[model samples]
Target: MSSNTTQMSIVCISEMKNSKRVAVEEEIIGMVKLNPFLYERKHEMYKNKCMRNKKFNELGKKLNVPAQQLKARWRTLKDKFFQEFKAELIPSGSADEAVKSKWKWMERLRFLENIYTPVDNSPCSSLNISKTVQELQQNMTSLVDRAKIIAEPSVPKSAAQLFFESLAKQTEEAELTPAEFCNLQIEILKALKAASIPNYLQMFCLQQI
Candidate 1:
């Protein structure tokens, strides 16, 4: 029947795509082995923008995939591997058999298990946090003014919504590295989640007079 044939075709297509992803990931990991700078975190020599771009271009030509797409795919694969196991390395034994079996890319992307960047304890980091708070406070001040102006309780936006919109706008407009952008997103979510209760209280109290 057509229904059974269609299901079979879908499975075949899924398998083909998964196989292609595996090939691409393997190619990337092999290249990283040859060029450690591609994944090294603290190496000054590996931080050369020119060399990095050249390597990525080389890879793009060889794989017939855009460099940015390759980078994004690698990010996704790394996320899967890390989510499976929180350790610095994947277990080779049978303990994580379920994880290894469920996520086929686990062994292939195990090299990324230790890519955790340590927290920066420098004064500049402190200043950056202070600046972020200042910018957020400024945004909230404007939103707060709007809230005060709204006479009806049902009309004003919640503080969390305002905060998310402002922060997301900043994120979208800024030219940030992928890692920095990801960290900012995490911070944004955490701040919004923590403020949820207070946000409701603030909205409930809005123009209660």
Candidate 2:
């Protein structure tokens, strides 16, 4: 073939490949939309992928389908789900609303999963929030104490004093009497518990905090 004809052929081949990919993607999405079982499996895979779980193949196996096919289309369906998820998050004319509050990454995920999940319900929604928050705070406090011990050899006494002083300042600014503060903490814990946050997820949230 002549040079121009060869270049045209290559371009045509590339276009054909792209067309095929697009068609396959559309087909996969169509299948997921129509099949509840497939969508459920896809949801499990997506959640496992997000957590960087080592045994994600287990989810694929649970689907009872060809492994290769499940692996190939899982990502595409997740992308489509997230796209629809973004639309649900901030529909037309809600750009201002989305920007109004700074949302954390996991918080956004929780928001999306809560509204619509391919499976029955959001996984994190089962967590006991009040207990999780309390444990998280206690863990953080323990961590800080350990850090103090670890750093005592290197950190100056004045610097240590300054850090504790800052914490005290924060406590003062909270402006609640000791009884009121305890009551407030109890109320916060109750609200969290009511949220139905699961234990493992509560730890995950604490680690993030």
My TM-score estimates for the predictions, one after another, are: 0.42, 0.31
lDDT of each: 0.51, 0.38
Stretches of model 1 off by over 4 angstroms after superposition: 1-16, 87-101, 117-209
- What digit string (tens of lDDT, one per residue) describes model 2 on residues 1-209? 55655322112212346666455445444444443344343445454453333233443344333435544565545544454444333313423232222332233233224323212232322332222444445433433333334236575554324444543455456564433333333333333334544333323322322
Best by TM-score: 1
Query: Which stretches in model 2 have alpha-carbon errors above 4 Å?
Result: 1-16, 41-70, 83-95, 98-121, 130-209
RMSD of 2: 15.5
The 10-residue segment of model 1 with minimum total lDDT is 6-15
Q: Residue 119 in candidate 1 has what lDDT?
A: 46
What TM-score does candidate 1 reach? 0.42
Error of 1 at 121 (Å): 6.8
Tens-digit lDDT track for model 1 on 105-188? 667656654454324532223422324534544444445444543445676666645554554455456655554444443333
**Candidate 1 global CA lDDT score:** 0.51
- Per-residue error (Å), model 1, residue 172: 17
Error of 2 at 35 (Å): 0.6
Q: Which lDDT value does model 1 have at 159?
A: 67
In the predicted model 1, the residue pairs found to clash are none
